[model samples]
Target: MDLMALIQQALEASGKLRDLSKKLEDADFKMILADLHSALADAKLESGELKIKLALAQEEIVRLKQVIEQRDKGKPTYNSEGVYTFEGEVGRFCTACWDSDERKMRLTDLASEFRFVGQWECPKCHAGYGAKDA
Candidate 1:
């Protein structure tokens, strides 16, 4: 069973024990029940905290697995033309983002009037590349 379910059960049991202890008239038994209830409450609190940490750790593991899958799918090839492209993709990828960040951000062509005739820019990093760099 999961920690969350166990914690919930412990909470319910503790409540029931508290009610039973209230109805009991014997002093010794009441004191023992109170001690057991306190320990159960403490365990429940720790279990709930552990559940949160476990969830965060599971999320991080999934994120790392996705990064590994992206890397294993295929390595982007360098054309040495100031850009990178995947094996089956037609769009040009940003060299800086791919090499430095392992990202596959596409490069956008700039208008000749605004920049050079064959200038391209990375939308994410804003790195500019010209045809002369090839």
Candidate 2:
């Protein structure tokens, strides 16, 4: 039915064949060989079916992934310029007080640039904003 089931069936058939080989002198050796042959045939058939099922499943997964990518493409995204505009007010205030007040202000004016600063505060009033906290 599935790849795993087919593999298990193949393993079971192999174990039976091993057992039959170990007991070659037994009276039912011929019958065991016949049963092993039948099991091997079934395993082969199951493996073929499993291969087809896996191929179909992989195709479906690819199709679904493409659909998801297309859906995401339609979603809105904030540009670097837009973020700079939105945070301009705070950045400007920090720059103005960078030298006058000394509360440790670390602000980046360029939104396109990425940095790992811990804190940003206004030197004049010590008012700060933590982007990570947000």
Candidate No. with top lDDT: 1
lDDT of 1 at 113: 79
What would you estimate as the lDDT of candidate 2? 0.53
- What is the per-residue lDDT of model 1 for residues 15-129, given as tens digits with 9 covering 90 to 100? 7877887887888977877787788778778887887898999999998998898798799887767578798788888888888968888899898775754578888988887
Worst 10 residues of 1 by lDDT: 125-134
lDDT of each residue in 8-104, candidate 2, tens digit only: 7776776777676776766587666767667777777777888799899999999888767644544222333221112322343343343343222
Residue 18, candidate 1: Cα error in Å is 2.6
- Model 1, which residues run further than 4 Å from truth? 1-6, 23-27, 131-134
Highest TM-score among the candidates is held by which one?
Answer: 1
* Each prediction's TM-score versus the true structure: 0.73, 0.38
